[model samples]
Target: MSHPPGLDLGQLRSHLDRERPGLVGGPLSGRLIEGGRSNLTYEISDGTSKWVVRRPPLGHVLATAHDMKREHRVIAGLHPTAVPVPEPLLLCEDEKVLGAPFYVMEFVEGTPYRTAAELAPLGAERTRAAVLGLVDTLVDLHAVDPAEVGLGDFGRPEGFLDRQLRRWGKQLDASRNRELAGIDALQSALGRSLPASPAPTIVHGDYRLDNVLIRQDETDGVDRIQAILDWEMSTLGDPLTDLGLLVMYSARLELPDSPISTTASAAGHPAPAELVERYAARSGRDVSAVSWYTAFAWFKLAVILEGIHYRYTLGQTVGAGFDRIGELVPVFIEHGLTTLKDPKNSQNSQNSQNSSEG
Candidate 1:
């Protein structure tokens, strides 16, 4: 089920003729961008203008999830708002055209940072500002009126948190390789300590630093967030969960027993607490209960990392990143365990209780 090298030039031209009408002309040139885990993306051009094409990965895809129509809808809904998202151009759900559903969007030009080391040249001040910009964007996103933005019906809002915990937990159980004692313990801990959440807000399911694109402006330092990539996981859910996941990936928590690096200087990232504080200040949202979110974040990450570890064990992926995933599993599990130790750290539960009482 390998994807076509790029947008099929002949088919693309034909599709343009019908849908877009004279937008794309002449032979098309395309370059593939690496590092996306789920979708197939390519930077395509006709030598004059550029565009991006997105389609499902080259293999069997779950029918219930990974729908191209949903991705297009999410991006399209965000375009009228302050959120920096790529503009969706065309959506083709007909499978005969590209072997699966596909969509095209304006090519957002900028550099994507995968590690803090890559951003080191910008110095701490500018890099921190850029990171804060992402936080601001998220604040604006959470503040948006989903009904006014035409995304109120995008996903199920009721019981979203419960569904998420159950869904990821099931995924972890189904993909386990060799018994992980910490995983079972963390699951039990999270289950018993589940928190209540406020009304569901739109959550970018996999928000992280790498998913944002940054560009340098000589006069004013780093400029605007050009675009937010990868909305496949966007949905109506607990917005704090998005913040928690960001902390899990971007924060440096103490891993006393693990050999992995625990500092920004060592692991090449900034502290998560600082980011959380920044978000709270800019958004005017209380983050005193963020610890529970952080714990849940680690739990979610551990499940994802363990799933990748299982794939690596089965010869699905070959690379240091995939191999190192197994080592990081225990680190994430430990974070979850530490968070669960205290019963008072239930951020979601408190929020739910407060809402119910109100």
Candidate 2:
């Protein structure tokens, strides 16, 4: 019945041996995987076979944000496809075992390069190829038919964009601690300028280089995208929303002593425009509407950071980065406003929509 800070190793071992015996070789010991915010990931090693365990954060819960069953289902569904996802093993909903529900999956061996410095050893050419490969892999994911993957009803895609806007606005209200000047204007503009969405696909709610594990050859050139981690924000929605977030994260921010992980500033990494163009050519989706999506991505991230910052103020958050989170919230607000002002992207989106209608 005893539990560690996040997981109870003894209870977890008993549950695993009972439910999925022979999965664990011996007694279990685990270390928490750092750098993750929403879900707590632990590398559980039974001194022989290793696996990864995912569960919701300690206290605060965003209903859809850190779902164990949802993540498990999506990964299991994608296991038969060409998409790279860890093979899900067993899902345990019994809270008595670990104080919370959790799931186990095969451990992926690769590096999640978070900063420009981390990718530096790969050399510039390899870095470019690695990042472009990330785009290529994304195209593969969108190409998947939801019905084919047994995830047709994963989410209600009707009015997905409107739902996203309202959802984030509500999130902002929930965590509002002080005055943020341009945030409300930016939200209002987004509500007024919602673009007509295309057909829905499984959207990786947060897609960036760091969210994936990239395995490299001995030459250090990127080999393959080993696995796409963190499916908590994933659902069936506008695929362009994924691209927008990728592009937004592709641009380096000027946050001093930033706690956020970003690899956009790395040399040999393509610009946001290049990534958009590649996705358009490959996926054959309209790229014009992406600017609005990217702006919205900023707003969503700002609200999320504010939530963390609010939790930090209340002493609910753990780890080193929470202290600097509030400092980055307003910066995200300003960037969202600036991104919306760019007529080239937003106007092009509207024009593209009008053309399609005509």
Q: Pick the TM-score winner.
A: 2
Residues 1-358 of candidate 1 have per-residue lDDT tens digits of 2234745756866787799988887667776788787887888888899998888877746844668899899889889888988989999998777778889999988877775456767665666566667778888888877888789987888877778888889999889768776888777766776667766778888787778887877786665678889888988877788787776665544444433322233222345665677788877776666666778778887887788889988998875557677888887887677766752443223333322322
Clashing pairs in 1: 195-348, 195-349, 196-348, 196-349
Evaluate residue 166 in candidate 1 and report its C-alpha lDDT on the 0 to 100 scale.
88
Q: Which residue pairs show collisions in model 2?
A: none
Most lDDT-accurate candidate: 2
Candidate 1 residues lying further than 4 Å off, grouped into runs, are 1-6, 253-270, 342-358
Q: State, as a TM-score between 0 and 1, how close model 2 is to the true structure.
A: 0.91
For each candidate, what is the lDDT? 0.73, 0.85
How far off is residue 274 in model 1, in Å?
A: 2.6
Expressed as tens digits, the lDDT of each residue in 141-204 for candidate 2 is: 9989999989999999999999999999999999988999899999999999999999999998
Question: Where does the lowest 10-residue lDDT sum fall in candidate 1?
Answer: 259-268
